[model samples]
Target: MRIHHDWKGLSPEARGATVAMGNFDGVHLGHRSVIDAARAAADAPLGVITFEPHPREFFQPDAPAFRLMNAESRANRLGRLGVDHLYELPFDAVLAGLAPEDFAREVLVDGLGIRHVTVGADFCFGRKRSGNAQTLTQLGRELGFGVTVAPLIGDGRNEYSSTAIREALADGRTRDAERMLGHWHRLDGEVVHGDKRGRDLGYPTANMAVGGLHLPRFGIYAVLIDVLTGPERGGYTGVANLGVRPMFGENRPNFETHVFDFKADLYGEHVSVALVEFLRPEMKFDSIDALIAQMDQDSAKARAILEAR
Candidate 1:
């Protein structure tokens, strides 16, 4: 997909596309439905309009940090979904204060050259979020563009939403989160050098450090880690511990994965780990030997689950 951070970067031909606008935090199932609908309606390109540093973070600094699909990950997902253009704008004080009509005129019409607009049913924006779906449809009629508002995509009582997915992950409900996301919850990071605790136990794990991005709740998970390169370039069954290594006297959170029946030197390499199932809560063992013994059991269970899938 063509991704442009600045308005000036968009081509003249790009102005008349169908546009879908939102934060699109995790780019979950609901977000996909809106983007796909816009793509189907547009004779021109399909443009995805998103904001960096989600406005909620700026507006409510005390709010829980967002569970976001980072720029690279979002781009990859959008490409997979056949998006033609991605417009990621900086969310600042000035942009945040734009009146609903002003945003529709300046960004949608003037900048993006949008012929049709799509948004989630609950979407709101511009100057105190006064721009509801009804407002947008009204504006679209006046502006000579079409507006499409998608109904809430859900399974009976559970609405498919990024917030709901975040809650699921935070509570270690991987399967529930996956149902809402239309895919497994994943973490992307580089393998970092660790204290060799896993190696000493004969489990040899690749450790990843969490960043500003959101992470699943602290626990053990059955995961599939795809090493970015090398002979083992594809997915491998593994068990990951996401938490402070209380067993080893570490005071900071870490992601440590033990690849079943695999051996490799992977420090400094990047990988994407998909959490398939939550195994158990992280616990401190009285001895390293006990931790190692428990890991053997976890590894066996993880292998069985991955095989069954």
Candidate 2:
């Protein structure tokens, strides 16, 4: 799919599309319903309009990391869903200041030339979120386009939403998160140099920094690693530690994965690690020997869990 960073000077073919609009963080089942609504609304090309840096990140700069997927991951997933075009609008001071009607007129009508637009029933837009699905419908009627407000999708209990997915990940419930997301929760980053403590302990690892990615519970987990852009280029089962190495006196959080029965130089390679199951909470051990013994047990348990899958 073609990703457009700005709406200005879009080609004729890029405009006049049926758009699904929202944050679309995880691209979960609920978000798919909105996209499906857009596809059903028009014969025009299917497109998605999402914010860059997320509006929540812009509004609450000091908030904890809560993104389920980064921009690159989200775009790739949307492409896999058959999106022909993706508009990643900047969520800067100017766009955030737009009033309700001005946003609808400038962005939806004149800028995108949208033939139809779809959004979740609870979607809100404009400065201070003063607009709703009803406002968009009214604007579409006046602007000569169509609007669809997708109803909330749920199992008559909890609705499918990014918030619910985040909660599950935060609690180390990868299966629950996957059930809502329709895929395993993954962390994507470039492998970087580390302290080599794992190597000294006889378990070498490929290390990656979790800078802005939403951290799952700090624990040992069974993971499946995919080498996205290197010679390895395949999935590998592994055990990973997703936390600060309290035993080593480290403070910053990172991912350290030991690919089972495999050794490869992964430095500078982009890899995705999918959390399969949480093994145990990260803990501090008194002696190196004790830590190594526990790691052995963790590795064995992870191997059993992954092999059984």
Candidate 3:
């Protein structure tokens, strides 16, 4: 899918399209319902209007990381869902100060020339979030566009939402998050060189920094790793440790994945790791041998869990 960073000078092919608008953090089931609403609006190309850095992050720069998926990951998932264009609007001071009517007039009508737009029932926009779905519909009437407010999708017990998914991940409940997301919760990054301690311990790992990415839990997890851009471009069942390495006296968090029985140089390669299940919380071990022994056990359990599926 084509990603348009700003709405300025949009191509003719990108104009007059139907768009699903929101933050779309995880692009979970509820977000999909909104997208489906846009698709049902008319026989127009499918597009998405989402914010970059998220409005929350823009307002609260010092807040803890809470993104379910980064921009690249979100775009990849939306592309898989058949989005033809992604309007990733920058969330800066100027854009954040836009009035409700001006946002609709400048962004939807003048910028994108959208023929139809869809948003969740609870969606709000513009400065101070003063506009709701009703406001959007009323604006659409004046702006010469159709508006759809999709109802929240739920599983009878819980609503499918990014907040619910974040709560599940914070509690180390990957399965629950997956149920709401309709896919495993994944972290994507480029493999970088590490201390090489895993090599000496007989468990070579591909390390990736988790900079600004919302960490699930500082623990070991059963994961499925996909090599997205490398010679080893394929999926592999693996075990990963997502933490600051308390045993090694490291403060910066990173994801270290040890691909089971696989040997390949993955430095500088991009990969996506899906958390399947949480194994155990990270703890400081007295000796290196103790850590290796626990790692051996974690590997066996992860292999069994992965193979069973």
| Highest lDDT model number | 3
* Candidate 2 local Cα displacement, residue 131, angstroms: 1.0
| Candidate 3: worst-modelled 10 consecutive residues by lDDT | 208-217
Clashes of 1: 1
Clashing pairs in 3: none
lDDT of 3 by residue, 81-129 (tens): 9999999999999889988889999988999999999999999998999
Model 3 misplaced stretches (Cα beyond 4 Å)? none
What TM-score, computed on C-alpha atoms, does each candidate reach?
0.89, 0.92, 0.96
Instruction: For candidate 2, write residues 106-183 as lDDT tens digits.
Output: 988889999999999999999999999999999889888899999989757999989999889999999999889888
lDDT of each: 0.82, 0.91, 0.92
Q: With candidate 2 superimposed using the best TM-score fit, by how many Å does residue 42's alpha carbon deviate from the native?
A: 2.1
lDDT of 3 at 89: 94
RMSD, each candidate, Å?
2.4, 1.9, 1.4
lDDT of prediction 2: 0.91
lDDT, ranked from best to worst: 3, 2, 1
Better of 1 and 3 by lDDT: 3
lDDT accuracy of residue 299 in candidate 3: 99
The worst-scoring run of ten residues by lDDT in candidate 2 lies at: 207-216
Write the residue-wise lDDT of candidate 1 on 40-152 in tens digits: 87688888888876787778877756755666667666776888888888888978999999888887877777899899999999899988999999988988889999887
Q: Candidate 1, overall lDDT? A: 0.82
